[model samples]
Target: MRVLKFGGTSVANAERFLRVADILESNARQGQVATVLSAPAKITNHLVAMIEKTIGGQDALPNISDAERIFAELLQGLAEAQPGFPLVQLKAFVEQEFAQIKHVLHGISLLGQCPDSINAALICRGEKLSIAIMAGLLEARGHHVTVIDPVEKLLAVGHYLESTVDIAESTRRIAASKIPSDPYDPDGGFTAGNEKGELVVLGRNGSDYSAAVLAACLRADCCEIWTDVDGVYTCDPRQVPDARLLKSMSYQEAMELSYFGAKVLHPRTISPIAQFQIPCLIKNTGNPQAPGTLIGASTDEDGLPVKGISNLNNMAMFSVSGPGMKGMVGMAARVFAAMSRNGISVVLITQSSSEYSISFCVPQGDCLRARRALEEEFYLELKEELLEPLSIQERLAVISVVGDGMRTLRGISAKFFAALARANINIVAIAQGSSERSISVVVDNDDATTGVRVVHQMLFNTDQVIELFLIGVGGVGGALLEQVKRQQEWLKKKHIDLRVCGIANSKALLTNVHGLNLENWQAELNEAKEPFNLGASDPSGERVSPAEPGDCRLYLEPGGCRSVRGLPARRLPCGHTEQKGQHLVDGLLSPAASGGEQIASQVPVRYQRGGGAAGYRKPAEPAERGRRTATFLRHSLRFAVLYFR
Candidate 1:
C-alpha cells in the first residue's frame, strides 16, 4: 500500500482538491491507498486567530465568518464543477462544525481563557473539514471511502498541544480495527488523544507526523509527502537563488536538516518512518511528473560531501560557567533539567573541554523564561559565588551544515569556517555531532542570510563566482567590458561564473543580481535611475562608502579624482597593501591621494605572467603606447577578477 500526505498548499482550492482526488483515485486503482491531509491554506491560522481574539476580550466573529466563507466558497465552486458533489451534505457538515466552534469560542470569551485541549480541538477543525470534502469528492467518483478518526485509533500520550504517539498501542489498535480492504481511506485523524483519551494534537506542522505514524502502523511500502516545492533543496531556494534540488538523502541527513530549519519536513516526521525502516518521498503536487527527493537508509556518497545547509533565525544564547563547574558531576543534568522543567527547548549546546562552562541556544522568544529558570536553578551556586552570573546574547542565528558523508571527509569544518571568514561573519558558538553528520554555528541574525549563501556557494557550487562593480566607464572600463563579453564563452568553458553585477560611470548606477547584459550595458547604465553619488556628500571629495562585502571594486577613471578615503579598514575582505603607485584598499582601486588624477601610466599592472608585480613600460611609438595601455587595462581587469575569487 502507498500512503500519501498532502500539505495545506496542495489542497488550498477546489482545483487542487480535485487534483488530489485524481491522485488518490489513480493510486487506489492499483492497491489500497490511505492519505492524511492538513487544512486548506490559511484556515488554521484563522482558527487560531479566532481563539486568540476571544480570549483577548475582542470579537472573534469576523475571523469565524472569514473561515466559514472560505469553506462555503470552496464547496460552492466544487458543486458547480462536479454534478453530483453532495454539496448539501458537505455544507451541513461544515455548518455543524462551525456551530461547535462558535460554542467553544463563546465559552473561552466568557471565561477569558482557552485551554490547550479546547484549542487543539478547534485548530483541528480545518483538517476535519478537509477530510470530509475530499472524501465526498472521492466517493462521488465511485470509490469506497473510510474515514479513520486519529483520536480513536492513533493513541498518543503527553501534553494536549504537542503529544507523542504511542506507537505500539496505536499499531495494535489499527491491526484490530476494521479498516475497509477495498476503500480509499482519507484519515484527517491527527486529533490524537492521551491515555485518558482527552483531545490532543501532534504539534504544528504535525500532519507529516500523522502520516508517518499511520504509515508505520499500517506498514505501508512507501510514504510520500506532497507539498508546494519540487523537493528538498540544498538551501532555502528563496534565500539562495541557485539552491539545487536534492534527488535523495539519508534518513539521518533529513532529520538534521529538518531540525536545523529545513521546512520541507517536520523534525518529528522522520522518527516514525526511520524507526520502521520505511522509505519516504517528498514530491510536489503541482508538478507530479518531477522525480522528487527520496529518504531511505543510505544516500549517494559520491555527491557533494555536504548534503545541505540550513539555518534557524531569531535565537538567543546562554552561558553558564564558573570555577565550581569544573569537574562537577550532575551539573550538566541540572542545567538541562532546569530548561526541561520550564519547558524551554534548547536548540544547540556546547560545553568547554575543561568543564568550566556550558553554553546553549534557545528561541529568542523564550530568553526571559530561560534566564529565570537558570537563575532559580543556580540560586545557591550564585549566592555562594561558585557559579558566575548567566551570560545572555540575543539577536543570534544558528546555521547548520549537514551530511552523512562529512564523517569520512577531512577539512569539511575548515572549509565551512573559511567561507564564513571570507564573508566577515563571526561564529558565536559551535557544535558538531559525534556522528559527524552536522556542524552548527551561531552567528548574528543580520549575517545569517549572507552566511548561508556564501557557505552554500563554497561547498555546493562547482563554478567560481566573481561579482564585480565597475566604477568607471571610460576607455579602460569600456575595453574591460568588451573583453569580458568576448571571453564569456571561454569563462563558461572553464567553469567560471563572471557576473558584472553593477556598472557605474560619473552619472548613474545600474545593478542586477542576475548579472547585467554585457552587450547593452552602456545603454542600461545611461538610463539607470540611481545616481552615481560617490563623494557627493563629502565636500572634501576624499572618502567614498565601502562596497559591500564579497564584491570587488575596480576604478579606471583617467581624468576624475574620486578616491577611497573614508572607507573603513575592517570592511576590506582582502588585506590592504600598497604596490607600485596604486592602493588596493577596501576591495577598491583608486589613486594614492585625494584629488589626485589616475592616469593609464599610474594604473598598476599586478596581474602579469609569472605572478609578479610589473611596473608600467612606456613605449616609444604612439600606436605602441595605445596597444600597451589596452593590454594594461585588460590586465588590470584581471586584478579585479583575482580579488573577487
Candidate 2:
C-alpha cells in the first residue's frame, strides 16, 4: 500500500480538487492506497483568525462567512463540472461543520474566552471538512471512501496544538482498524473523519505528520507529500528567486532544513517514516509531472558542497558566561533545566572552547521567559560575580546550510563565512553539531535574506559572477586587481567569475558594469577621461547619486559623511556599500590598533617616505618617516571620493 498526503494548496479549489481525484485514481490503479488531506489552502489560518476575533469580543461572522463561501463556491463549481457527483452530501457536510463552528464561536464571543479545546476543534474543521468533501467526490467517482476521524484511532497525547502521537498505540490501533488500503474495497479505506472525540489537533502541518504516521503504521512502500511547490529548493523560491530545485537529499538534511525554517515540510513529519526507511517524496500538486524531490537514507551525488540554505527569523541569542563557568560541571545542565521549566525552547547553542561561556538561541517571543529563567538559575553565580548577568540579544536569525557531502569537503565553513563576509552580513554566533550534516550561523534579522542568497550562490552556482568594486587602484587596489587577474583562470576552474565591475584611483574613474577587463584595467584607468570625484557636486552643485550596485556584487565606495577624527571613515569592511561609512576606518586601522607592524611592512617601499596631503615627503628621523609612510599607505589603501550617495 502507498500513502499519499495532499497539502492544502493541492486541493484548494474545484479545479484542483478534481485534479487530486485524478491523481488518486491513477495511484489506486497501481495498487491499494490511502490518502491523507490537509484543509483547502489558507482555510486553517482563516479559522484561527476567526477564533481570535470571537475571543476579542468582536463579531467573527464575517470570517465565518468568508470561510464558508470559499468551500461552498468550490462545491458549486465541483457540482457544475461533475453533474452526477454527490453534491448534496458535500453540501450537508460543510453545513454541519459550520453549524457546530458557529455555535462554538457564539459561546466564545459571549464569554470572551477561547479555551484550548474549542480552539483545536475550530482549527481542525479545515481538515475534517476537506476530507468529507473529498470523500464524497471520490465516492461519486465510483470509489469507496471511508472517512476515519483520527480521534477514533489515531491516538495522541500532549497539549492541545503541540501534541505528540502515541506511536505504538496508534500503530496497533491502525492495524486492528484494517483501514482498507484499496479505495476500491467495498468497505472503503479507513479515514480520520469529523468524529469529535476529545479533539486534539496536531499543530500546523499536522496533516503531514498524520500522513507519515499512517504510512509508517500501514508499512506502506512509500509516502508522498503533495504540496504547491515541486519540491524543496536550494533556498526558498519565494525569497530567493534563483533557488534551484534539489532532486534528492537525505532525511537528516531535510530535517535540518525543515527545523531551521524551510517551511516545505514540518520538522516532526520525518520521525515516523524515517524509522521504517520509507521513502518520502515531495511533489507539486499543481504540476504532477514534475519529478519533485525524494528524501531517503542514501542520497544521489549532486557534487555540491551544500544541498540547501534555510533560516529561522525572529530569533534572539542569549549568553551566560563568567569566570566561574570555567570547569563547572552542572552549570549548563542547570541552565537548560531552568529554561525547560519555563517552557522556553532553545533552538541553537554554541559554547566556548574554554568553557567560560555558553550561548544559545531561542524564539524572540520567549525572550522574557528565557531571560528570567537564566537569571533565576544563575542568581547565586551573578551575586558572587562568578557569572555575568544573562545577556539577551534580539533581532537575530539563524541561517543553516545543510548537506551530507559537507563532511567530506574541506574549507566549507571558511567558504560559508567568506560568502557571508563578501555580502556584508554579520554572524552573531555559530553552532555545528558533530554529525556535520549542517552548519548554523546566527545573523542580524535584516541580513537574513541576503545571507541566504549569497551563501546559496557561492556554494551551488559554479559559474557564479562575483562583482567587485575597487575604489583605489594604485597600490593595494592595483595589487588586488593583479591578484584577481592571476586568479581569474583558477577561479574559472572553480566556476567562479571574479568580475571587476568598476575601478577607480585618485585621478580617474573607470567603469564597465558588464565587467572591467582584468588584463587591461590599468590601461583602461590611465586612458579614462572622467575625473574621479568623491561626492562631486553637479553643475547645479546638487549631489549626483552613484549607480546602483549590481544585482549581485561586492561594493566599496567612499563615504559622503566624514567623522571628526579625519579618518577616511566611510569604508565598508564587508565590501558592501550599504553601511559603507560606519567602520571603514576601524577596519583599515584594525591591524595597527592590534599592535601589529605587519601593516607597515606590507606597505610598498616607494611609499615608505614621509607623506602629507598631495604626495610623500621625506621626514627627519627614519622612524618618523616610516611612521608617516605607514600613514600614507593607509591613506593610499583607502581612496575616498565616490560613494553611493
Clashing pairs in 1: 543-566
Question: Each model's RMSD to truth, in Å?
Answer: 10.7, 12.2
Give per-residue CA lDDT, model 1, range 4-67, as digits (tens): 9999999998989988887887777788999999999999999999999999998888888889
What stretches of model 1 exceed 4 Å from their correct place?
468-490, 500-645
Q: Candidate 1, after superposition: displacement of residue 454 in Å?
A: 1.1
- lDDT tens digits by residue: candidate 2, 70-183: 998899988988757788877887898899988888888888888887787778888777777777778778777766657777777777776777767877877788776456
Ten residues in sequence with the least summed lDDT for candidate 1: 597-606
Instruction: Give the best candidate by lDDT.
Output: 1
Q: lDDT of each model, Cα atoms only?
A: 0.77, 0.70
> What's the TM-score of each model vs. the native?
0.80, 0.73
Predicted structure with the largest TM-score when compared to the true one: 1
- Candidate 1: RMSD to truth: 10.7
